[model samples]
Every structure is written in C-alpha cells, then in structure tokens.
Target: MKNSKEWYKLDAFAKTYSSIISEGRTTCFRLSVLLSEEIDTDLLKKTALFLEQKYPFYNSELKKGIFWNYLQHKRNGFSVELENTYPCTDVKRENPLKIIYFRKKISLEIAHFLTDGIGASDFFIDLIEKYLEMKYFKREVNEREVGNNEETNNLKYKYEMEKSSKNEKISEYSDLYSKYMKRVNKEKTVKHAFHIPLKILEKGQYYVTTGEISIEDIKRESRKYNTTVGKYLLAVYFKILLDKYPQIKKQIVIGVPVDLRKIFSEKTYRNFFINITPSIDPSLGSYTLEEIIKYVNNYFKIKITKKEFYKSIYKAINPMRNIFIKSVPYLIKRIFFPFIFDYYGERGYTTGVSNLGILKLNRKYSKYIKGFRFLPPPSKRCKIKMGIISDESKVYLSFGNLTANHEIEKEYFTYLRRRGIKSKISTNY
Candidate 1:
C-alpha cells in the first residue's frame, strides 16, 4: 500500500518549545562532520536527495492552523545548499531543515521542534555513511545496517507511556515535590550568576571557539576526582566562574540537559529531554575543584535516578492532560506561553552544557573522518553555551558565544592546561 498524505500533531514538549522561538532564540541544534578532504558538493546534494526519500518525515514543513501548528509533508523536493547565515535560523515553507556544505564540512541544522540531539545524531550519521558509500564505493549501504539499526526514521509519533504503577507514580511525585520544596524554601530568589561580558554582535552573528583535548588525560583526571567526564567539566566551569567573578556570594547554577531515552526506553526521534540545574554556592565557603566535583556528583546521584527521571516526565506531561488547558485556544496560549517560560525557565540557569557523548563509526568510514563537533544554539540570556563530543582518541569542547570576546575560552583552556590536559584551540570569529 502507498503511504497517504497526513498531518502530524506536535508533542507536548514541542508545543511548549515552539512558543519560545523568536529572532533571538532560534531553538536550532547543529551536528557536523569534518572529513579528511574537501567535500564533494555534487555528491552531497545527491546524498541529501536520497536521505529525504529515506526519512520522509524530515522533509515536512511547519504549518499553522486554527488550533495549533503542525507538520505537513512537502509536495516539492528538499534542497541542500551552502551555509549562508548563522546557525539555527528559523525554518520556512521552502526549507524545514538546512543542509550546508562548506569546504570539508557538511552540517545539518534542524529545528528543535523536529527532534532532539540523539535523534539528529542518528540521522546525521546515516547521511554521512550514505554519502561516503556514494563517494568512495559508488553504492548504497543497506537500510538494516544503517546508523544504530534503530527504527528512528518512522513518522509515527511515539510518547512516554504511563507504565509505572499508581503507587510508584505517587512515590515518585512526592519525592519530586519534596526536592522542589527544599530548593524553594532554601533560596527565595533565583540567583543570576556572573556572565563574561563582551560587546554584543549586530543582529545575526555569533562566535564559535573549539578546543581539542586528549580523552585519556580527561579520563585520568576525572578518575582521580571519582567523577565522570561530564561532572568534571562542569566543575571546571564552576571554578572558572568563581575565578572570573570573585565577588559572587550566591550559588552558580549550570543548566544540564539530561537525555530521557535511558529512562523511558522510548525510540521516537522527537524532543525527550529535560533540563536539570545543578549549582554550588560560593557563600558556603571557599572550596577546591575536588569539593565542587563532590557536590555535583552527589547531586547527580540523588536526582538522576529512574524514579526522579519519571517524576520529571510526569510533571511535564500532566499539565497538558488538563481539560481546561486543552480547551484554551491557540492564540491565547501563544501570546502568553513565552512570558511564563521567561519568568520561570531562563532566569534559573547561568549557562548550558550538553555532552553529546562518544561517536562511533564503521572502520571504513572512521578513517576518512577527521573528527566530529557539536555546536549548540546561540542564546539571548545565557550569552555563552558549551557542547562536548568525543571520538576514539580525542574529545572536542566547543564554546559558542553570542558576544565578541575570547576571554572565557582563553581562561578555560588555560585552566585545563594547568591541570596537565593539553588543548589546541580553533575559532570561527
């Protein structure tokens, strides 16, 4: 049977996130691969065409209706062009996702409403593999042997299931509320930590600086502190803030995005992550890097468990289930949703740090690739964001800034070097 044309409804997370999009916040996530040689533009274009057919859902464009915005399959074909503007620009009728070729780099920039990091990574790997096969071997890789061999390309929307027992839900809910109350009662105001000051860009420009470090050295340092790489880097971040702004007496909060796939075991390629803010207060006392790591480690142990994770999922979904909220019209919701988010969402965190984890590829394709780097979306409030990704031998830390200064990057890499981890810095200013 032939597939029929149909419109797909946006998930709860997508609906809430879409309202926050504006010229300032593009809500775009980028995944790019650096090849050993210059990219073949013609071949990349062909591969993109093949990919559009393979993953039809990605080819759809956003549409606004009476009730809400939905995705409608495009009648025309997709296009892959050279990158012309800054990362994470808004998607339109002609182009929903942009594929750009610049020298040896091929990047895929997708709207956050479409999918999360993991989902985008899956698609990106598949596209690279196909492109390589077409470029070198002059053939196609089998669908079954594609990236992860997971059925992430399916268009059918999948959501979290309320599989936990009633007792389990109640227990998790109570625990979550207890934690929330503790934070609220402990600190009355959301502490806005010090941000590195720089001359703001004109309109659509941003800055990107990258550092490559040895994974082995990072692991050794992390093991010495009895913590994971993510926590260790986060600790380093907190230390930098403390050194830069010595007068901040309150807590320093960092927004970390937690992947929900491990908790729900769901394979759908939509947004399925939550932000958890972990902080360390300077008022407590002067502390060393090890102490900061200890604080972060304990926080993760307490908040990252399966039970706590489910509590977050329910908290996000339960409001959407309310009959009253469902009855409200889209215009009213669109008008006020962003204000609610700004008051309760953006002000809580000093900055965002997302670790894309490790990258694995077939031996044949791995040798052709130089490395992988993930650049997070630019922000209006946070000003600077950090993204981490690693290959077999090295880890790449990319600091993306909306302002025009290298002070933060310089201090950060210098700190890593002082700790005996060598780093090489690159930039796109």
Candidate 2:
C-alpha cells in the first residue's frame, strides 16, 4: 500500500523553527538510546530504511510555499551516519531527519519541526528493537552447520519484508485545533529578561553533562517538597542561579514547556508543546530554595491549565494568519522572522527546564537497553539548557551548555548530592 501520510504543510511549531533556521540556530533536538552491545552498522542501516518506509510521515524536507514554508515528501533515501559531530547539531532548514550511531549508542537528531520527543520516541525504540532482533538472528544463522536451511530462510524472509501499516499514519492526526479550544485575546510581553552572563564557547563547540539519579530518590524528594518532579527540578534550577548570581538581574524567567497532547487528547506527531515562563525577582529580596519551589508550584498551578494552553495556541497562530503579515513575501519573512522568534523565545528566559517524563517502550525489551537521554536545542541567548528523561530505575538529567560556565552544572548536581539524592555524573567538556 502507498503511504497515506502526505507532507502537505508545516505545522505551527514547524513554521516557527523553520523561519529561524538561518539565524545560526541548530534547531535540532536529539533522543538517544544506549544498548548493552555494540550497534551493527549494516543491520542498523537496513533497520533505518525499513522504519522510514513504515513511518513515512518522517520522510520530509522543508521547502518554500508561495507565502510560507511547507513540508514536502522527500524520496531521496534515509541518512544514517556515524556519530562524529556534536549531538543534535543538524541544520533543519532543508535536511531530513538522520540516524547517528557510535559503538553502543544510536541517536536520532531531528528537527523540532519534525516531531516532539514523545512523538518520536515510538520510532526510536522500534528501530532499536528491530535492529537488535535482526543482529541476533544473523548471528544464530552464522553459527549453524547447515548452508541452506528452510526454517532459517523463512525467518530471514520475514525480516527482509517491508510491511505497510494501515493504522498509525500521520494523516490521522489533524493539525487544526480551533475546533477544540477557544483562543486567548491578549497577554503582556516581557520587555527585558535575565541571560546568564557566562563567557560562551567558540563556534562548533558544546558542553555536555549528564547525571544519573535514582527515580525513587528524586520522586521522594519531590514529594518531600510538596511538588511534582518537573516543578521541583525547576525550583532547584532557579535556586542554583540565584545562589550563584543573585545580584545581577531583577527578574529571572524560566521557560517551562507544557505538553498539550494530554490536555486535548490529540496525538499529532508535530510540535504541540507551549512554553510558560515562571519567573522570580531578586529585587524583591533574596529567597531560599524552598521559597522558589513553592513559587514555581503555585505559578504552574495557576498558569498551566487547559484554558491557558488554548490561549497559547491562539497567540501562536494569529500572527501567521494576520492579513498584513500574510501578504508579505517569503523573502521578507526570511529576514524578519528571527526578531519575532527571539522576542517570544530565548530572549525572555533565563534558562529552559523540560522533563520529558518517563521512557516507555511499546515492547518489553527493556533488558537489552541501558537508558535514554533527551537533549534540548541550545541557543546563544539561553547558553545552557536542560533536558531530562527517566526509565524504571534512574532519571537522566542532561544539561547541554554552550558557554564556558562549568560551575552551573556543578552547583546543580552538588545540591542534589547533598539532598541525599546522589547523582552519578558525566561530562564532555
């Protein structure tokens, strides 16, 4: 059967990321998988092409529409490469999503325009499962005495076959949201924000640091704090920056991404999350870690609601639908979109906090895997951003730093260490 998932248009968040592609932003995010055994490149390559056909919705490239940018179905073959460069460093302007692999690691460095972490996690896990199955079966065959065995050949045929899926196609998920939620009328803008004053690293360089903490310990701590895991982590981030650099800015804004899929019960593979920046002021006076956690809990309780998400959807779509803005050509938009992106994006936030919840598998193959990591996109303004995800055992707290500031991560993990929630940390500085 032909793929029903046609690439027609770029979704809302896709358009935003696409416009800012030229402004020196990588705009790509990564979802990585670590396995117990080394990845077989040949088997993984076969698995990659097969999965691309099964999930043909992802076989897309960005192209120019008459007025705006659109996604076109790309038939130029899937890209699978060795992990040589920085993670999530792919330019998302015209490139399709890629699969990068090292010895025991496989990562999907995809554009935010392609899909959010939750949506793409399905594909990532499936590819790993399939690759592992194929590798083990081949090993079994090579060890056998027979040259042309019927039973072995039958299993080989099954693995080689490309099966088309009637269900789970991307076309089933609609991009339109006006039918479900009402739009918010207006909201104020942040004129000024606090950016970390750390000296930045040079071009093509990124600092990677990860901490492995027990899920039970972190959950216990969050419970102790009377908050959720995400809010608790956000509070810890706020407290770290405050403790380190308290005298600098009046306001410290942190952008928290709210997954809207759970809100409307829609499972669109495109980007559907909204950012709600919850901030604290140093000018009001210095505050303790507990105070910041309570403030974050209270702020999210009030601001991150179903209704608030709907308003965010409205604000995101309105400018694109504007009569005047719509009339402008793509050339003008290419030049002007960065300002809009910066104003509403990294410019207003001290840093970002995103916890991608848990790492769940469709199949019960967790034994063969080690863990997972969700790497967020980094920008010049938000020099160091955090991405977190967990499994049954431990929570992986990953911070991708673009500056020379090593103390931020040190202080963050050190605090967790003192709280009786010890974190096994690693870095690529």
Q: What are the RMSDs of all candidates, in order? A: 6.4, 5.6
Clashes of each: 0, 0
Candidate 2 per-residue lDDT over residues 145-238, each given as its tens digit? 2213546534433332322123323333346443343556754546478888888777767778999889889889999879988778888999
Give the range of the ten consecutive residues with the poorest summed lDDT in model 1.
156-165
Best by lDDT: 2
All models: lDDT? 0.72, 0.74
Q: What residue pairs clash in candidate 1, if any at all?
A: none
**Residues 302-410 of candidate 1: C-alpha lDDT, one tens digit per residue:** 8877667655666555666678777788788788877766666666677889888987777799878988789887777677889998888999999988887778888
**Model 1 misplaced regions, further than 4 Å:** 1-4, 140-199
Task: Give lDDT for model 1.
Answer: 0.72
Q: TM per model?
A: 0.85, 0.88
Q: For candidate 1, give the lDDT of residue 374.
A: 90
